[model samples]
Target: MKLLLTSGGITNNSIYNELVDMLDKPITDSNVLCIPTAMYGHPWVGPGVKAWKFISGKEENPMVNLGWKSVGVLELTALPTIDKDRWVPLVQEIDVLLVSGGDALYLSYWMKQSGLAELLPSLKAVYIGMSAGSMVMAPTVGEYFIGWTPPDDSDEALGLVEFSIFPHLNHESLPGNTLKAAEKWAASLKGPGYAMDDQTAIKVIDDTAEVISEGYWKLFQT
Candidate 1:
């Protein structure tokens, strides 16, 4: 599997190049399905919903700048209520799956219910994840604040990658997401993990793995 797990959306040349390399084709040639389902989980009902929806609109979409000719948003939670036969084929045809940031557990829940988790491994697309999207692809995610409280019986992710990703490390806006908090979280984790900020990404192509960053990041081990 090929995956480019990013803390932020693709915001730099290096990250864009990494994605192009992973796709083995120009992004213009790729059919990108941008999943903004995770962003749908904001706790507040009225204004919060409107806020996230506005932030996730076409004008503000990160995928738009990628130059992909065919870019569309597919909300996982909306799948079951719609025409599955139509949407599933559309999803399968994409060359890249771009997942956006929001509540990680909420995203995971919908992915599992919507059958995306089962389809992902076999797709020809590269999985591109940003923030919450990146975290849910991990075997388990060390908390970075997505506001969803899991039931006592649940908290698992897709397990697409072995270790958890703690994104937005030391980011200015997220004051509580300090390296100190990261260290404390990593200390309790069962396996290795990574703490990355916006300018960094973890690229994994089957057996090989490496950190590609334009900003600071770190590997944490138990």
Candidate 2:
């Protein structure tokens, strides 16, 4: 039940140190598995590689350069046709599961359809979610009403936490990702929610959640 849900990847020392501490071993000794399946929801460009690049074309992926002994990407969409036995072993060996951000609904779709939601709880690794990745771990995604599509028609989540996470708050690059917009979205939800900017993260261990950040964030309750 160790989870480091972040608005973005390890952006500063606070988050980097937190992750190092969570690993309990030297950073270089860890094995990380990156999942970019959420990117599937975005508009397809050309080939499969191009579509992947479209979602992750930014600078270096944080997980790959996090000093882990090895980093691998698991395209969860391929799970439907691949043998579970193979992927399950790969999942078990990782020290961390780094979930990338894109469309939250798309990520949840594969997680549910591929049985990842159920399998994650049993894994001993730390779960690190960024943006859309962070949002899907909540009891519900709530109504985003932003660039990404709201969680499917049902608007549910993996139920990993009691409340929802509204990430990328006040992020200048993402239009409409302001505090006012976040508050409006949070108010629409039936339960509690947290609005986090790029420098903030919510670390959840079992039922407890601690805010770790060097920047701004807000917690809203009904």
Candidate 3:
């Protein structure tokens, strides 16, 4: 399966080339599945919902101007929370799966619960992860949360790659409170981690990730 993982979004807001290149093929007639982490507030309501409608070509969103068809929507809160009996079949048709940004620890918990921990790696389509999405893909996310939590119970990511990742390292516009939280999280780390600032992303095509663009980029190896 081909994979394209973007940290956070593209460009000043999100990087477009990386995301566009992943698709390579045209999107007009493709089957894409966008699974949001349970940490997200609403499933199919508000802004996310509105945008999804368009991506799915439902006419509810302006993005329909772009070619997209939402085939499946999965919200994984925990391992046993969904009706698995019906989902196994639906998961097969997905051509792309996108994971949004959120708490790395919490997101990892939910990915395992949703059965994706076992399924996603083998998928034949594209795997697109943003922000924390990129962080958790690494074997162990280093110095991720500068806040309170248990030991490294949730820090052992999915082991998709054997490296630690840090997101939004030096975006000056970010609120001081959020930056402080990250600083606190980084301070508590027992080992090394990679820090990525906005306008930057580290693309992991195989086991190796190629850092892209300009920003605060570093690799902390223990």
Candidate 4:
């Protein structure tokens, strides 16, 4: 699977272009399924209008609003009750999976529980992740980003990529998420990490990872 991980969604033209490149097709021709499970786990962003905005493309972050040929929701928490034959084929057929921003660990947990995490490696679709969605691709999100706790009481994520991410770097509203704070967070990680602002995104295809940014970002090499 290809990955386009962003702090904010496709906020700028640079990131949007990168997303198109990853798709290898026009956004208008694409079939999309958005995963809004992450929002429900977040205290401030969840189980309410915020999730609706994200699904309806009314949220500030642009994901579902990109004018795809079709858009559907894949709520991870609801997957277990249904049979795999129903949704599995749909997942494989989709061109893109738009994951929302919220609580990373909670998203990670549902991904595992819903069988999406196991199915991701075999998928041919592009995976676009915003905020917590991006963070869940890492091995661990670190304690600082931890909000909703998993049953196992671990910070472990999907580990789809080698490096971790510190998102929303230096945004005015999130005063605590400064570069210095990100640097400190990166120092505690065991592997390479990135601190990226809203306008920055990381694109990954197989083993290659590239930074596509209109804003600032720092790579902390371990």
Candidate 5:
């Protein structure tokens, strides 16, 4: 699995482009399994994965015509049915998983309820994650006690990686103050971690990780 972790994807297309470029073949030949409900403030209530359109340029519309097969959260969580016609094949034979940006807590919740949260980490396909999607793979998250939302005991992570991820380290590209903020957050962690800035990403295959992009890839620890 390839985890491409980014800060925030709503305003940037670098992560998406990178994943698309990394694809083994043209997108037309493959299907994409996208879960955008991870981010807080999602479209639907429970397990809000349907909110990816905001950043995908298809806001209010779940389906995007990218010339590839897609199974999105919008159609997955409907009460009546699981939408087996679209979701089953995507999950069983899709090319890759594309996780979009959102609050980490919400994302984690949906993954747990849907059961895909655990099954995804071990897949043979490409796994592309940005922001909250990547954050869940870390050892821990800034939940109830810390993070974008109030903590909840039920909110746990998939544990794909052994470290935690800190996004938007500089407070939205403000600069100068980022280091100070990162130092504070890093000090709070139990082990080594990363504070990735916007436009920057961490690409990990197997157990090796390479910092991608020119922005800061701050290493932190108390």
Candidate 6:
């Protein structure tokens, strides 16, 4: 799977161009499915209009609004009750998976339960993750970003990527997301990590990973 891990969504031209390059086609010709299940588990972003805004492309983050040929919602919470054959083909046919930001563990839990995690390795679609969505690809989110707890009460995630992420670094709204705090967060990690602002994104194709940024980012190695 191709991975476009972002702190915020496609907030700048660099990130946008990277996504287009990954797709290898015009945005207007692509099919996209957005996973909004993560929002419901977050206290500040959940179970309300925020989810609607994200799906409808009214949210500030540019995911579903990217002028795709078709856009659909893949609600992880509802997958367990449905037949796999019904949705699996749709997932396989899509060009991209737009994962929204919220609670990382919660998204991880549902992704596992919904059987999406198992299929991730072989999927051909590009996986675009925003904030917690991106963090879920890491081995663990660390205690600092833990919000909703899973059944085992662990910070463990999908482990698709080697390093962890500390998002929204130095953003005005999130005062605690300063570089100092990010440094402390990086210290608690077992492997390497990145502290990136909204304007930065990490693009991973196979084993190669590259940083595409318009603002700033720091890589902290343990």
Question: Which candidate leads the pack in lDDT?
Answer: 4
Cα lDDT over the full model 6: 0.93
Off by over 4 Å in 3: 12-15, 41-67, 143-154, 173-192, 214-216
lDDT of each: 0.78, 0.79, 0.58, 0.94, 0.60, 0.93
Estimate the lDDT of model 2.
Answer: 0.79
**Superposition error at 180 for model 2 (Å):** 1.2
**Tens-digit lDDT track of model 3 for 101-141:** 55666667667767878887677667766666676676665
List ranges where model 2 is wrong by over 4 Å.
Answer: 43-61, 145-152
Candidate 2 versus the native: TM-score?
0.90
Structural similarity to truth (TM-score) of each candidate: 0.88, 0.90, 0.71, 0.98, 0.72, 0.98
**Alpha-carbon shift of residue 154 in model 2 (angstroms):** 1.3
lDDT of 1 by residue, 1-222 (tens): 588889887867888888888886777788777787787775542235543442344434354456786777777887878877878888777888888777788889889888889988877788888888889987776544536766643567888888888888888778988889999878767888898888899998884679999998989988
Consecutive 10-residue window with the lowest summed lDDT within model 6? 142-151
Candidate 1 lowest-lDDT run of ten = 45-54
Error of 2 at 35 (Å): 0.3
**Decoy 4 TM-score against native:** 0.98
Error of 3 at 150 (Å): 6.9
Per-prediction RMSD in angstroms?
Answer: 2.7, 2.7, 5.2, 0.8, 4.9, 0.7
